[model samples]
Target: MTDDLLTRVDNGVGIATLNRPKALNSLNQPMVDALGEVLAGWASDDEIRAVVLDGAGERGLCAGGDVVAIRESALRDGVAAAKFWFDEYRLNAAIGGYPKPYVSLMDGIVMGGGVGVGAHGNVRVVTDTTKMAMPEVGIGFIPDVGGTYLLSRAPGGLGLHAGLTGSVFTGADAIALGFADHYVPHQRLTDFTAEIVAADVHTALSRYAVTPPASALAAAREWIDECYAAGSVTEIIAALRGHDAPGAQQAADVIETRSPIALSVTLEAVRRAAGLGSLAEVLVQEYRVSCASLRSHDLVEGIRAQLVDKDRNPKWSPATLAEVTPDAVSAYFAPADPDLTF
Candidate 1:
């Protein structure tokens, strides 16, 4: 459909490849539109039984949406960034509610917007090289693209830990945290997809998928559940610091480095998502948060530090956790002007 996104049909399966290997196949406006168009066209075609998403290079499936573009737009009118998210969030919902089986080959470096596209599919496959993360907190953004919905549904504190700390977890951790289903080694990925194209999704899964290795999250669940069970972000961090688990103190330290206001809003967003009945409902809430974030100083600064300047030093407005008031965080919940509709 476009240079950034390549689409093809083989047998009964429609295959789409993200073609920007050098930039980790980071999604742009055109790629997102192409994916939506392809999926919409395939949704009604009786000849296509399933759809698969893959990245062109060996590096990864997708890093994320073009945040650098978002940063530039945010530095401008913020209109373009909003439109990108509006369409991208809709695409995320379409993938989740797709009529036919949607398969996501989540091989490596799947993060943020990447999770929106790859993890929402019904048949999500992960490999050992897969490193999935919702690292928005690191860039002064909340996890959108139904990330709150997926993470909120994760067992106990694992989801909150991921959202707050912005840490990357392995494929085993991805499966444990409910981000993916079957495990197929990278070496067999091509053969496995061929199986799906030749036969059907289930048959391919049965033939090549195997049990993933033990996840670190599974072992840390005892303390993770206990610490993250706190009602608020502050309390959660304190609990992590006080806990004796292997990753607890480290998680607390990592969260301390993120934008304070972003962390506060992210905590509330994930918590609110837990109560939402469906992914669409959660997306609506996420849209509100995303719009609110665009107006905030942190989002632009976050992107500048992480992408534009590569300084890795964002001076968040509210520098400390205690400085972030409840009202400041509540502003992110207000209804967006150009609202998102399903």
Candidate 2:
């Protein structure tokens, strides 16, 4: 196993800890490979009755995948980044389909790839410190790693609002939106994990589950549903802009800062994913968009501005929402070579 990931067995539990605390445990190719191999072994191991996944850090469970690494690879050759996504997506599918009871302790910032690892588990526990989002659009990419499947299934149109604005969700908000199964204080995580190793998964989780505080997203459901249910990105932006509510206007402003192509493509992906039957199906669709994104000028520019130069200002290809046409957006859905399959 790689030094970045720790794996062990205690009693009947298989424990995996993301060990790169300094980078907020952000996943790299090596870490992903180590995790996938370990989980595969535990899946068929009769001695392992349950699996517990957590990250080593005070700041968060995981920030996201190593986007800086992906960016560097993309700068040299697109194949490297594509290979990372292919492997990462396969790991995501494995986590979602794991036969054994899988529990995730999500204590802090869970976003993008972080969401894929934790949220897909059978039992997801969030704490007061948890802050989650699928903020891929900010970096000029659609939310992949089954994000479309998760977000599209959210009640009403809250998911659309979140996808478009890259809104952050608190622990309570995550449970409210069905992204998390339970809430336990951060202090109790150690004991809860130990309980899983000693007892049954359900019993251990029930022992620690607590009612989460009121969800901010729940309070804004009506506004989110009304504004985000529009037919297109332009329509949604117009609704947000015209609304008298401060939340709507603020959301609109945030959307404006993101790449127009990314937002438009994300909306299309979410809408299409809503009708799909399975995570595998959504992943294949996402793969197409992900590959297309690599070829787009925005992906490089966005990464350069956000990470390489730390400029925080990306000059998007389609500078305005109006410039992102239906044909342009549709091209992203075209099938890729060696299509992603279950």
Candidate 3:
């Protein structure tokens, strides 16, 4: 529908390609709307048996959401930013609930909103070059886009470690952590997509899927579970610091650099999302936290430091984890106005 997203129907397969290669196919409101519209149309179309989603360009599938744009909107008019999240979350829900098989080729960088689109699909195909993360805390935000649901369900305490440190995941690591379903070689991806268009999705994917390399996350799971399973962020950090392993100490240091409030609230969100049964429910909870985060000084400051200023120095309110109060974290979970419902 828009140049940012190219859509077409090839035989019984509907293909959607993210076209903003220069931006690493980072999503904006227009791209989100076009994707939602195309998916909705194909959902009921008898001719379309399945859909394939991928990004154009050498870099990756998508970098993330248009954070610079969201930051600008948040500063000028909070309503615009809120609406963007509303629509984006709805699209995420649609992808999760789509009736037809949905194939997402996460060939490169898949983070934030990109993860929402690719990971939530029925068939998530990651390649050797694939690098995935939910690095929201670094930007003064919690992982949204139904990230809580996905991460919360990860094996052991791996999800908590991921959320806290914003660790990047390789294709093997993604599969090990349950974020991706299949691993296809990057060179074979185009051919694989063609096969899907010509034949069946499951059959084509199975034909191309290969066993990934040993996951680094799997090797570190014992330490991760031990460090992140603590009841609170302070305790988690203390555990990480007290751990004998170098990796655990490094992880502890990484968490120290992120926004304290974001880290605190994100921990609560992931823990709570673990109990939730549905993606829709997780989206609602995410919405509440996101809306509350908009009013926090850290969100805007985080965006400014990371994207705007590029100084990489964010002055977080409640500068230390201990400064983040229980009440302040609880407020992020309070119900949003006109609550997010399917």
| RMSD of every prediction | 0.8, 1.0, 0.9
Per-residue accuracy of model 2 over 81-151 as CA lDDT, tens digit each:
88888888988999999999989888888988889999999999999999899999999989999889998
Better of 1 and 3 by lDDT: 1
Write the residue-wise lDDT of candidate 3 on 211-246 in tens digits: 999999889998999989899888999999999999
Worst 10 residues of 3 by lDDT: 72-81
In candidate 3, position 177 carries an lDDT of 86
* Predicted structure 1: lDDT: 0.93
Off by over 4 Å in 1: none
Best-to-worst ranking by TM-score: 1, 3, 2
Best by lDDT: 1
In candidate 2, stretches whose alpha carbon ends up further than 4 angstroms from where it belongs are none
N/CA/C clash count, model 1: 0
Give lDDT tens digits, candidate 1, residues 133-214.
Answer: 9999998999999999989999888899889998999999999999999999989999999999999999999999999999
TM-score, cand. 3 vs. native: 0.98
How much lDDT does each candidate structure score? 0.93, 0.90, 0.92
Clashing pairs in 1: none
Report the error of model 1 at residue 2, Å.
1.5
